[model samples]
Target: MADTTNRLAGIAYLTVDGTNYMLAGDFAYSVSKVARETLMGQDRVHGYSEKPKQGSMSGSIRDAGGLSVASFNAMTNVTVTVELANGKTIIGRNMWTVGDLEVKTTEATFEVKWEGFSVEEA
Candidate 1:
């Protein structure tokens, strides 16, 4: 088995059916403050713009079950919410076909980056 301690902040790709997908994105415990803050909404407003904008909202990754499992089934659709420390939640859906499940892990955390999904507005 892979030690999984050196995979921090690395991204893994999974092949689902005939499509290539991101199986997971490992978020390191040592993630940059900017990234953590952006993911957690501690920092918002990249700078005010008079024009309208389209972009991802700030929030943290959340799950009702939390981070317990390391692998997910192929041809599966998973919805995981990243909850900002501020209590705001962003939902992401992963739709994939059945294939060899892949993951990138660290001693602290692991992730399956799901492709073919969209982020729902909070």
Candidate 2:
């Protein structure tokens, strides 16, 4: 039978250190490699080469005291975990924050993103 739990409920959360934060917006993650063409053939494309898989995640949290811009900036060698409603989880180790956090009088929220080694499903 097919699992349709995800269609019934939308729930995803981010865990940094030991704290969990419900994602304010959509939580997006990706694992990809940098592919390039190898030696070119005479007329057509030859082979291809690929680097290691790169993993990253981007999401926003409601402006709160759990994570401040200064605290997130000082993080290093951290583990990030994402839990989905479908009983799926992905983990990223040694990930660091590489974000473009901006503050405005109109709003207090800040954007967050993490990039590091390959993500592993757990």
Best-fitting candidate, scored by lDDT:
2
The residue ranges of model 1 lying beyond 4 angstroms of the native Cα positions read 1-75, 97-108
- RMSD in order of candidates: 14.7, 3.7
lDDT of 2 by residue, 1-122 (tens): 96675563378878888777657777778766454558778998777876676688777766665556677777667888988777778788888888666644344566778888767778
Return the TM-score for each candidate structure: 0.32, 0.76
Show where candidate 2 strays beyond 4 Å.
Answer: 1-9, 33-42, 104-107
Q: What lDDT does model 1 reach?
A: 0.35
> Measured by TM-score, how close is model 2 to the native structure?
0.76
Local distance difference test scores for all models: 0.35, 0.74
